[model samples]
Target: MKEIAQSENIEQFSLKNYIYIDKTEYIYNLIKKYDRVFFSRPRRFGKSLTINTIGTLFEKGVEPYFKGTWIYDKWTQNTCPVLHLSFLKFSVSDLDNFKRDFCNEILKFAKTNNITDFTDDKEPKVLIGNIFSAMPEDMHIVLLIDEYDCQLTANINNKELYEKFRLFIREFYAVLKGEKHIRFMALTGVTRLKDVSIFSVGSDIKDLSYDHAYSQMIGFTREEIKKFYIDYLKLGISYEKHIKTDCVTDNDIEEFLDRMAEHYDSYCFDEIYENKVFSTYSVNCFLQSISQNQRVIFGDYWYEAGGIPSILKNYMESHEIEIDKFQTSEISINYDDFMNPTSLPYMNENVLMCQTGYLTLKSEIKPPRRIKLGSANREVKAALNSLLSQKFFNPDALDSFYDADSILEKGSVEEIIEHLNKVLATIPYDKYPVENESILRALLLMYLSGLRCDVRSEQHNFKGSSDLLVNFKTRRVIIELKFSKDGKDTDTLLKAAQEQIRRREYGIEKLGDRELLQIAAVFDGSPNMRKITEFKQIG
Candidate 1:
């Protein structure tokens, strides 16, 4: 076996030696045409790495350092100053100080270029404008901004400050977007904020984020992985450990490669990537592992270094929804938009889902054009499901969600809820975990609603959702759950819920399936005053 263990040659392993695919070539092309360029990416996904690579190409003092780089051989154009700023280190405690933070980073970038004259300026944007103007006219100064979305992302719900800070950013970036003095500008971030103004006001900017041609630019393709791993495979590091067992052969590389691809692939550009993407971050992390002679990094690459499941969970819990609902629904308005009026911006859940990697675009036709996008491929879906299920949601409350047998099982399903109701009937529902327990119960009911039933949230039931419906089951149930912050009374809440359910004809659609649909009301913690009622769905 050809051994390329990490201890054997740790010093020689550099991305420069590894063939950089995708976005790299296109970025160089853009550099040739424009002076200032901006790009964005999520955290730990190689945003800094891309900038460092660009640094090797154009940093004023690092010119001779590009000796073996592909860019060194092909980039014969005149040199320009590269202004790179990574704002990951910047703290955004409040939006009010975002401009100050941004301006300070701009100062740091300027200082790196030895421009320290106006570091103390109060009007930092003006100073920034001046710095752009000060760039030598003969050479284009490349402006690379990483994590441009950090400030805004750090405070998603602070509408007033976010909008104010966004405007500050708009005015600052406008200097580069203007006709004179600026070369090409590239800005990058995790996702887009509709009111960020960068997308709307930037005149000539083109988003290559979703461009298929540049798709492989930022990541390792299935083909790249096979080639890169050929050496590792020969090293006795058993390809079977990662791709297959020793029984595999060269002829099996195709099937083995396909398996490797599925576990790690996900598309993110309007879901343009689908399962085609190889989680660049994950692949790199794997390569790091393989080079270190660690064959099994983790079960699947998607669960490890690729995407942060916790971040997704934070979004889900904050929104009070499940991961499955996100996979199935479209998000037109962010929860921030719901919390703050000015933050209202239409978000096509599909597009946002695609951009963020949960969904991928499936099809597009030119003549009779229509775009079809859907959840990531089966492999990614499985990985995501596994990752999300393990998240902390009252860890001690429920060890697991309903399984296959628990679901779609007639007597079993009813018994599961009935068991839950009996348990709930005895407990105090006005406490901390009470809402979660009740919500957990609701989630089980919602899961059952599936193809046969439909559900929505409203405020008629009490302080929480008015009615939740499940139409497919033999008897549809109109469920409502509410709790009081201070008092323990749930009698009124239960009555309101039952009345609302009846008035809205919650089980009207289930009439054909059964003569009666269960109608129950709980005052949550209304002493022993809780009420349970049943009614017929028929006329």
Candidate 2:
């Protein structure tokens, strides 16, 4: 396959010459039902572009950009005046500056329409009133606000400051309900602050964040990928010359699709099973990386663009949440949590995760229902692992655990035990308090996670549940753990654990022409004086 170079300007903002995704149909349908709408999505999920598209669609003449798009023939003949305000173009730090920035946007739009009635000195609400009153009654204003919650969300650390900004925004947008000349209005933000004054306005605003009708509005669908970028993908996959197959078949293409889906797809905004969409930002990054270097690299494009929001990092640290808890997929959260305009006084982890796009809606019932949460994709999982490792675990300790994993794959019990002890020694005193048999198992699971192993905790069998089972490429490692509050006979506990694994025949079914490595870990003493007592293995 001949290599094709993708545009390096994928990250640049330009509505012209853009790969116009078919969202016009959705927008047309949306405007017909709701005059005021609030759409919330994660940052860089193409909210800005969508806003621009709406604005351009209402322009006087059908621009060349919409020549062949869905809206070309279906759009209204008379274009209306568009008043677009972007919160990102301001250097706002406080409520005053935020108001000033909004007023500036109003003044700029007024100048565009040849109306000189607005001033920067006026309050945001007064300026909004002046602009709306000055517009011709025949030319209804198309109001579009992008990054509407930027000021409040950016200052989430300052409770008083966030509240002030939220109040100002609410009061400013409160005019939307009574504005008579406005034809349509849409607001976009990273999160919805339901309790905030803005959304409490009497306007009947529809939230499209989790609505199934617009699930694919922000991201690329699988079929869209194959239709738009088949050539680019073919060239990109050919660069993976390391695949051991003699000749690539149709299965290889499917495998490539699976790989992309694992890293970037599976973002479900709605409870519906078929509503998932890939992150458009990550997809472009992936294609751009592969095209530029001719190699597949799933580097931290989204996470690195902007690391986990500082608000989330502080929350996690304050709560002292273990990193492994992210793997727990059955967390429950209320649907209203994401709609509130103000930050919750005491936010739930699942709610925070879902709103910030780390966890997405997995399944749900209708009204008064609890929604299930799970990781958005492997890209997010890898980002969390990187963040957790850097924040909690020492580099040397992680290295030792990884080295121990390699040794356990083929080495004897004594060799693996020595390496694992080194890893355990790196645990600080603070981590000691959380130490227990479960923590030990979690530690092993975390270490094994670095490798491409299929690890299961509390794996069930005929006898009982095994503590941990790690299936490597060629071998199976079955581990059981026991804990003691005092420095007692942990040796016997280790022996008993090994015997339990043997009795259950944990690895017998899949041990054909491969090795079954059984190991036992025993912890002794209380939290104040705790350490691993002994490590045993059954060959």
Candidate 3:
């Protein structure tokens, strides 16, 4: 064993330097049952490391790395002729180049086994069979492929080009089927390319993506945190002394853990067991921040390093969905709906969000079959909030929204509308088409929620629902929104809006003694143009 340092950087991610979380034993045991396996997980969730671990365990002359781990003692000398490849290492400009590079990679593996009968003129898809033929009859080949769908994800927006790449890759992967010479084959990637028709051939290939047994494979469980991170806990003292300039205590350490979990944990994949797991990338990033700054710093490091996927941004805007609604709505998608891919501009936003790691599975329903989803954690929420604020709300609108806190504090509905109209006026003309009153409502709802205000849209009350319900510590605001076509009287629309709120008695049941501010707003325009007709303090 190497001399252990009093404080080691958890961000040092090599297996030799990294603290082994013991998932390798579980993974090795579970994976041995299947000859061909496919596992998909979000990026930076430790897919590469897991692939590396598996390769190390199976390949010859790599026993030194596993010296301290469970796989070291429990297993016999079980080595195989391993052929490892990662798509990250290859970038091709055209189909011919891709084919050439692919064949060369496979041929390189064959040469290592001291078999060199394959020619450069051979097709890449059939190259695997040639490699299989060249190997000794007694030996079986172990094939490990990492980031199998990297090219497709990298060019997701270019559907025309991506389709070509997908077709070629799918055909190549299809070659793995019925290959008796293969001892084990595993492919790992961030996404499952369901449309590609790659894994359709084999019932033997296990998709451990959502399996409960492997949920803890790619990331940290709470138990793993306590077991592996005990030494780094004391780094809080160094943080307090050097950075925070405050006293550090055991309570602070506990608080740090809680905050860490809140920001980066709570990603659930399995339907039967909704196990919360931390994103290994974010955890390492957090630990690295603490080590470098000698203090705890909360950030969207994952988002910072890897921004929101462009596909997600395009989906929200094209659907004309309110950014706030996209953030908060109770989205449910059937299993088929979640897995199947439609064309761009028509893709299911909920599925895209869930698969991309922004949203985590919340619950599963059977018989009609649906999955409920919400933001994975505070990090995701923060990233979305920042994206929404940037894409939709301008500084003037944001200022007006913040001013609403004080406007509501004074129980003045008219003043609140004045602030809101300021926000409305500042909205960029190209923000959204604002085709109808619904879009207008969505704007306000999204903005208010983004500000971290307790705002609900279409919240049901005793008699009916309020368009917007703003909650405060000791008060509540009930708002009714109305829209009119051009030439409609602004005063009449405002009166009708007020009448609806009064008729519903939105706050009668719950606003005892606490301030109840009733508001009404009216707007007029076609989808192309809109202006506020009236805003008033109804009560």
TM-score of each: 0.62, 0.82, 0.74
- Give the top-scoring candidate (TM-score): 2
The Cα error of candidate 3 at residue 274, in Å, is 2.4
Off by over 4 Å in 3: 1-16, 60-62, 199-203, 237-254, 310-325, 340-346, 365-367, 385-539
Ten contiguous residues minimizing lDDT sum, candidate 2: 4-13
Model 1 C-alpha lDDT versus the unseen true structure: 0.48
Candidate 3 C-alpha lDDT tens digits along 1-539: 12122122222334437555667576667656777788877766777777766766677433566665666677664687788888877773366776777778888787777777654445777777677666677878788889887777666656677788888776776777777888888888766656666544344577777777677777788778666765565575456556442345667667767878878898887756467798777776776666677677766777787776655564555555455446455666776666555432345666666767877778753435776778777677656665565567676445555666667666466667767777776667675555556777877776665555667678887689888888787788877888876637778988888889888887666666777777788877644437665777665
For 3-87, candidate 1 gives per-residue lDDT tens digits of 2222111122342254344344655776666554434333444456566556545643324544444555577655556666655
RMSD of each: 11.4, 4.4, 6.4
lDDT for every model? 0.48, 0.69, 0.68
Candidate 1 at 530: error in angstroms? Answer: 17
In model 1, how large is the Cα lDDT of residue 359? Answer: 55
* Candidate 1 structure, TM-score to reference: 0.62
Off by over 4 Å in 1: 1-24, 33-44, 60-69, 112-119, 133-139, 233-248, 266-275, 287-346, 365-370, 377-379, 382-394, 399-539
